[model samples]
Target: MPLNKQFNKDVCRNLFAKDSRRLFLKRTLNSATITLAVSSGLLLPIQAIAAWNEVAFAATNLQTAIKSVLGTDLSRASDKISIKIPDIIENGAIVPVTVSSTLKEVSTITLFSEKNTAPLVAQFELDKDCIAFISTRIKMSQTSNVIAIVTARGNNYSARKKVKVTIGGCGD
Candidate 1:
């Protein structure tokens, strides 16, 4: 009777071993599939979020960043482009700015601060169906000149405003 009980236990162990091996293989395959998906950047639904312009964002000055983003440094100062921002801000952390263009066929609007560490602040891409206007809050390191560049029909138009900041946004 003892020998029979021992033999039964050994058979049960052998039967469960195959199930554990299968489970291990299944777990390994699932892990590999997830790794591949993440490596290929398929986890994000929007592809544009992953696509970043390094040159424009990494530029240290206003001119370089503008050239990197707009492909040219020459922009004509336009009266048709209106920039609405406070001349003086108590806190540099939240500075409201609105840019509107009366020019036809506006394609893009880009904002910059001349004295900021990285000047290129924000950019808005517009199509024919949309209006040529953008409003947003941007941080200013100190008292600097804020510039708005509008691109319309292959021509670049610009407007600049000087802002006085009482408190520096860059923790100065």
Candidate 2:
């Protein structure tokens, strides 16, 4: 039962010391493994993706501008995109427009008002991997066609809706 009885005191003491040394070595090795992983770039967190591109802003007409940005013709009506606006904006100081696309792999989305002097209001650049979707506010000179153009995977698509203004909110 007693190691000391079977072996000499010095020998038993040596065996106990050897076991303790092995434990220390094991802990040190484990710590070093973690350090190596971080140094080798295997433990870093990924950065957030920014989806946006700044491209040409040109459109003679709403459709042309939509084409210039998206590179394809839009559907007559699509179930994929939904454009939301007030039936009548009593004030034009700040008109809200919301555009959402159910379509997959959308690259960019833009909004334009046909009647405005400069029809091209805003251009959105979706990063290469971003799906098409956006919401924004645009100015309207009068009751006009507010167009929503979406670019997805190098193809162009869009939707349009006419909104009525009870009062001239665009500082007429």
Which candidate number would show the highest TM-score if scored against the true structure?
1
Superposition error at 30 for model 1 (Å): 7.8
How does candidate 1 score on lDDT? 0.92
Point to the candidate with the largest lDDT. 1
Q: Give one digit per residue, the lDDT tens place, for model 1 in 1-172.
A: 9999999999999989988999999999999998898778788457557566799988998889999999999999999999999999999999999999899999999999988888999888898998989999999999999999999999999999999999988766
Per-model TM-score, in order, reads: 0.76, 0.58
Worst 10 residues of 2 by lDDT: 47-56
Given candidate 2, what's the lDDT at residue 113?
Answer: 80
* Model 2 per-residue lDDT tens digits across residues 1-172: 5876767877878998998999999999998997797677666433234333234254456556655665655544566888898877766556799888887777767778887765777877777566565667777777877887776665666788888866655555
Instruction: Sum up the clashes in candidate 2.
Output: 7
